[model samples]
Target: MFKRLILVLLFLALVFGGIGYWKYRQFQQMTAQLTAPRPPATIASVEAKRESWQPTLRSVGSLVAANGIAVTNEVAGIVQEITFESGQRVEEGAVLLRFEDSVERATLESLRADRQLAQAQYKRAAELIPKQAVSKSEFDIAKATFDAAQARVAEQEAVIRKKTVRAPFSGLLGIRQVDTGEFLQVGTPIVELQALNPLYVDYALPERNFRELAVGQEVQLRMDAYPGEAFSGRVSAIDARVDEGTRSISVRATVPNPDGRLRPGMFAEVQTLLPQRDDVVSVPRTAISYNTYGDFAYVIAKGENDALTVQRRQVTTGRVREGWVEIMKGLDAGETVVRAGLVKLRDGQPVTIDNSVELKDAEVGKQ
Candidate 1:
């Protein structure tokens, strides 16, 4: 029994020894991997240089019609004729609709006949009063009768005019709202009218930029419908007060849209260029490494024998335009910065510059 126990102990010792030897070999392999030399990373790079950049403010604007309205009838009447078609362009005071007014027309003629008779009587009374043939009270009565008849005629004419609807101003009309023979009540809509040659753009900017805003400043506009086409406008008005809730000031600009391509209620991207231009150090937007702590970029430094190494730099970025960014601080003009392969880079990491891809990317950005 003692001999069997010794054999079991020997087997246990061999098992543990083999396990320890395997673990030691694994440790040595990991140590070698940790101390291995890293290879140089190939990255695209570009040189930062002085660029003339204009500071611009960007916002989304809503297009509005300079003059827009829903045309409505002022009086109740039965529609007899529609003179204007849907979507027609009409001039001011042009006839748009005609309401049934046979009764009003007949009334007007009857009043006119009564006015003529009263006028004859008034004239005869005037002649008699001059000769003392008629008393003053009788002559006054005749004058009053003539005046009442004339007023009745004028009143009937006004009623007839109200039955006919005309365009209040020259503009394009929307779809026809009322059909011929349809009864319309007072304040019933007839159609929508809008002047389309010129449009107003309404947008707001932060109150901090209020001092930079002024009337007559040029504005640039872009819309998805017209890709690559930019619309120009001028700042027409600015609100007197800033909104308390948003801390923004309202602004209005007038854009000429002669072709009527820009319709009201369309959204557009608006950019306002400041009066001053800045000479700033500019770099490609791709070169920026945005992080939660801070924004940074990798700048290449030349070492002995012209070996390139990347130095991580924190940057204060300003306005960006056309795939480029303005570097406000932490970098200088004429410095080379790594433009690509940023994910595999660190501070003081060896890198090799490859401009073949970088040059092609720059040309594409320009286009």
Candidate 2:
């Protein structure tokens, strides 16, 4: 029994010795891994520099006509002729439509004959009154009759002029609605006239931005119909009162439309160029990293052997224009920053920059 107990003790000792040796082997492997040097990461970066950048505020709006008028008949008559074609350009005072003036012309002629007869009677009566051949009352009655006939002629002339419908202003005529010999009533719409040489763009500005806008400020305009094209103009008018419900002010800009390509009611994107900020800093938009915490970017700092160290920075960004953002704070001039590959990075991670092709300011401007 004593010999059996000694053999069992030896077996337990062997098991414990095997476990300790295995643990020692694991420790040695971990130690070697910790001592090994990590490889440098590949990344693209750009150097911060100062450039003249004009900031712009962007909004959406629509194109409108500066002056649009609906041509209507002033007198009720039969439509005699439509002198102008649809979509035709007409000058001020050009005839648009003509109503039948047979009745009006006859009335004018009849009043003229009566005026002539009254004038003869008045002349004859004046001669006799001065010579004491006729009484003063008879001469006075003749003079009054002459004046009434003259007034009747003037009234009929006005009615005849109203028969001819003329363009009130120089503009392009819309579709013609009346035909020859068709009877029209007073105030009936004949056609629409729109002046397109100079266009007006209307948009609403938020109450907070009201202070930034002013008369004669330069603005940029873009239409979805013509992509990649930009039109320039200036603010011509601003609403004096703000809307009580929306708290927004209506703004109008005058754009030169010499070619008459811009039409009324076209959707447009507007950008107001506010005054340049003297103390604002800006950065490429790609440098910014957005997360749950906020927006962040990695700035390159010098490390050992001229290598770069990435230090994460929190930035307060303002307006973004042409793929660049105006930085309110958290960055400075002459600093270097990582441009790409920022997703696979940390606060203090080491990075190796491959700047064979640097980020050009012109390329960034195009975006």
Which number leads on lDDT? 1
C-alpha TM-score for every candidate: 0.84, 0.80
lDDT at residue 265 of model 1 (Cα atoms): 87
List model 1 lDDT by residue over 25-75, tens digit each.
999999999888567788899899897777788999999999999988877
Model 1's TM-score against the true structure: 0.84
TM-score of 2: 0.80
Whole-structure CA lDDT of model 1? 0.88
Per-residue error at 10 for model 2, in Å?
15
Clashes of 1: 0
Candidate with maximal TM-score: 1
lDDT of 2 by residue, 75-185 (tens): 899998889999999999999888889988998999999999999999999989979998999999999999999999999999888989999889898898888989988
- Listed per model in order, the count of residue pairs whose N, CA or C atoms clash below 3 Å is 0, 0
Q: In model 1, where do residues sit more than 4 Å from their true spots?
A: 1-37, 117-148, 356-367
